[model samples]
Each structure stands twice: as C-alpha cells, then as structure tokens.
Target: MNPKVKTGISAAQTGLKAVKIGKKALNLKKKLPGEKKKATQKALEKSAKKAAKQEQKTEKKQSCRQRNRRALKNTKGIGRIALAIWNRYF
Candidate 1:
C-alpha cells in the first residue's frame, strides 16, 4: 500500500480503538456543566408537562361541573310546569 493510504488506515484503526476506551483525551468540554444543564432542562420540561396536565384536568372538571349546573338550572322551569300538569291530572 502507498504510505498515505497506510497512514490513513492506521489512523482509522487507532481512532476506533480510542473510541472503545472512552476517548477521554478527545473531550473538548468539561463534563459537569453540560450534564448539569441537561439535567436541569429535563427537570424543567417534566415539571412543565406535569403542570400542564394538572391544569387540563382542573379545566375539564370545572367545565363539566359548569355545564351540569347550567343544564339543571335551564330545566327548572320545565320541572315546575311538569309538576303542575301532574297535579292537575291527578
């Protein structure tokens, strides 16, 4: 093989070996800060999702209650007329 091709193959082999050993020398950044930021972002996103779900549940409960109350109130007059008709028939 040509020297240049041989050098490239050797370099590739060395790089693959380095990868198997974790490549600690190839690191460009301190690990802690990046890890901390990633963890913080994940927690924030999780809490936001939880809060959104809680708010959705509360909204569903409130809307259902409001609808039930409105429907019952709207039927109050009909109920009274119905009762009066029943009394007259009896």
Candidate 2:
C-alpha cells in the first residue's frame, strides 16, 4: 500500500473515532445533569451529591472511550473491506 494512502486512511479513522466520542459524550450529557440541582448544605450531603455527579462524569468519559475504541476497531474492519474491493476490481 502507498504510504500516503495509509496515512490518509489512518487520519480518516482517527477523525471518525473522535466523532464517535463526541456523539457519545453529547448523548450522555443529555441523559445526565438535567434532573440534578444546585444547592448548598452541610458537608456530607454536599460531598455525596458532588461525588455522584463526578461518578456520572467518569462514566460518561468511559462511555466515550469505549465508543472510540469500537469505532477504531470497526475502521480497521472497513479498511479490510476496502482492500478486498480493491483486489477484486484492480
């Protein structure tokens, strides 16, 4: 394979992975953060709520990570498909 073509395919795969992460994060943020409220209180309850939100954020981050991983894996699979098509035609 041409080095330039390989570079282009890698860049495209990376861009697609980023898009997958962005979509996952946006969807997770929508699912979270809405029903929560802003309030002040004693130390323990405040800390607990803060912890919960932090956990949600962590989960969202992990979800994005998983989505990106899947996208990259799928990108490799698609690259093989493209190669197969190229071999068949040319």
Candidate 3:
C-alpha cells in the first residue's frame, strides 16, 4: 500500500488506543455529581455525532477519488489513441 495510507492507518490506530485509555481513566475516577454526569454525557454524545459526520465525509471523499480514477483511466485511453494518430501523421 501507499506509504501515506499506511501512516494514516497507523495514526488512526494510535488515536483509537488513546481514546480507549482515556475511557479507562474516566472509569477509574470517582463518581461525578448529577450535573457533572449529565454534562459528560452531553459531551460524549456531541463527540459521537462529530465522529459520525467525519466518517461520512471520509466516505464521500473516497467515492470522489474513485470516480476521478475512473475518469483518468478513460481519458488515458483516448490520449494514447490521439498520440498514435499524431505519430502516424507527423
């Protein structure tokens, strides 16, 4: 695979590990007051929504990349044919 893609995968894995560790740390803490608990719940929900949006964005970008690749492939075939015709004439 591409080096950049590998690096991104590695970074994502590290981030996942950090999030897991953070959750564990949070669990170790003493119970928070009712208001604090509600605040934490809201924050977690917000973060979850943000992550979902990011995932959808990533998927859209990947689909666009695939479409661009397909377009380039089609153009490359036409380009080669044009080059052949030019070489034959000039």
* Candidate that scores best on TM-score: 1
Assess each prediction's global lDDT (C-alpha) against the native. Answer: 0.61, 0.62, 0.71
Model 3, 1-90: lDDT tens per residue?
Answer: 664685477558657855875584466344787777777766765775676567657756776787799899999999999999999998
lDDT of 1 by residue, 1-90 (tens): 454575466557655654643343223223446776566556655655565566557656766777798899879978999999999998
Candidate 1, RMSD to the unseen true structure: 23.1
| Residue ranges of candidate 1 with Cα displaced over 4 Å | 1-32
Q: Pick out the ten consecutive residues of candidate 3 with the lowest summed lDDT.
A: 21-30
Best by lDDT: 3
Residue 5 displacement in candidate 1 (angstroms)? 71
lDDT, candidate 3, equals 0.71
Residues 6-54, model 2: lDDT tens digits: 5466557656655665565555555655433122223334555565566
If scored against the real structure, what TM-score would every candidate get? 0.55, 0.50, 0.53
lDDT minimum window of 10 residues, candidate 1: 21-30
Between candidates 2 and 3, the one scoring higher on lDDT is: 3
